[model samples]
Target: MGDGALSGWERSSTARVIAPARPRKLAKVPFVELADGRLQGVVSSGSDIGRVYVSSVTAGEFAYACSTNNNRPCGGARGSYCNHIAAMVKEAVLQYGAERVARYLKCDLADAEPDAASLTRAMLATRPPAGDSKAAATVFSRFLRHLAYLEFDPATAPLPEMQWFPPTRAVA
Candidate 1:
């Protein structure tokens, strides 16, 4: 009883355990350029990331890549922004200055706040030119609106509208 009880409670001398370090979040950076002269930039928040491209197709018209990929055309026959759009825009603003690029794009640099509400309004206001179906145009418009809403308020943003075309009947 003298030594046995106290000996059982003796602390073992061993190295303390440590937890692993958390991975660092990726940084937003301008990285690539497209054939049409659009500059691409990557923005990352943890694992989620996106790209933006900025370019001018005409003398006074500036365009930006609002989508994540560059596989499709943007407006009708006009080229669109792929994943590289955002980066391009950021680089352009740095190289040409925001004022010059805004003038070239015919946009107000003063209102260029990347807020979701403002972006949603702009997307809804834009309508595709004639020849594109109303449904298609509506879908595209809704897409941008949804993106804006998602950016602003992910917790309460509505689900993206889905379009369903009737299946065509094959000739017998």
Candidate 2:
């Protein structure tokens, strides 16, 4: 019982505790970088199957955890990285090289050298004209309204819940 491995009644005690089996491949989902040096993403067991939130911290050392069944073995008893970690790393590496992958995981930009031309372009894009506050305010308001309507629109929404929603019926 002291060892990490559980057997007999302990393994069978809970339905969430899945016994060690073949490591199923994970389908990659879009990942977001958190402010606190972590990456969060949702993965599915298969197409439209069990969705679980996966997060990883890649600071000094790399570590990942899943929101699904926690009783699953970490390396399938082989002492290697678990399926979740492996999948996440693979997805990250595919998007970014091994050397740059850490940047996304940690959201660290200290080492990145700034490009003067791009920085200038970005600053100019963000800065408004010298005057015409009323026009800018009106445009900003319209932009906010467009964004708000997007959340209620099904066709353009990416989330499944936001897609194909039916009209809400009022009850007397």
Candidate 3:
């Protein structure tokens, strides 16, 4: 009906968000994002309301880890994923859905119906050859960096710091 030009902030490519079947409650997992070749985010501690865990599952590597922001290894992440890890997976699925998460992680899944639990089960417990602390800290640092964005007051014009960011990133 008009000139074939992309709308503002709209991409002409296949890249777009895959919304969850049901909206997720972000309170439990305040942050969940897919980046840096993993599914990572901050999950509120179950035992201590004041604490938060930085968790991530490396894509393809299938390596995972969970710990406090201060680098305290999660007591529950022994030979298996902790509840915080599970919760992060669930939130990732909620935000991006199961199929997308599986494909991103390159998970070799069974015939089971796709869900966070199934996706979690598919990941092996092989720890990354590198130290988990370094990886977790990187993820945690990113989380804090993003959190800092929320402190910015509303602006009329684009922020100079973010001008280099394209309107939409191509989905890999």
Winning model by lDDT:
3
Candidate 2 has its poorest 10 consecutive residues by lDDT at 128-137
Please give the range of 10 consecutive residues that has the lowest summed lDDT in model 3. Answer: 163-172
Off by over 4 Å in 3: 1-23, 124-131, 158-172
As a TM-score, model 2 comes out at 0.35
TM-score of each: 0.26, 0.35, 0.73
* Winner on TM-score (2 vs 3): 3
- RMSD, candidate 2, Å: 24.0
Full candidate order by TM-score, most accurate first: 3, 2, 1
Query: In each prediction, how many residue pairs overlap at the backbone (N, C-alpha, C within less than 3 A)?
Result: 14, 0, 0
Q: After superposition, how far is residue 5 of candidate 1 from its true place, in Å?
A: 99
Q: Which parts of model 2 have CA positions greater than 4 angstroms off?
A: 1-27, 32-35, 69-80, 103-172
Error of 2 at 64 (Å): 2.8
Misplaced by over 4 Å in model 1 are 1-80, 110-172
Q: Write one digit per residue (lDDT tens) for candidate 1, span 123-150.
A: 2244322221222233334434545764
Q: Candidates 1 and 2: which is better by TM-score?
A: 2
Better of 1 and 3 by lDDT: 3
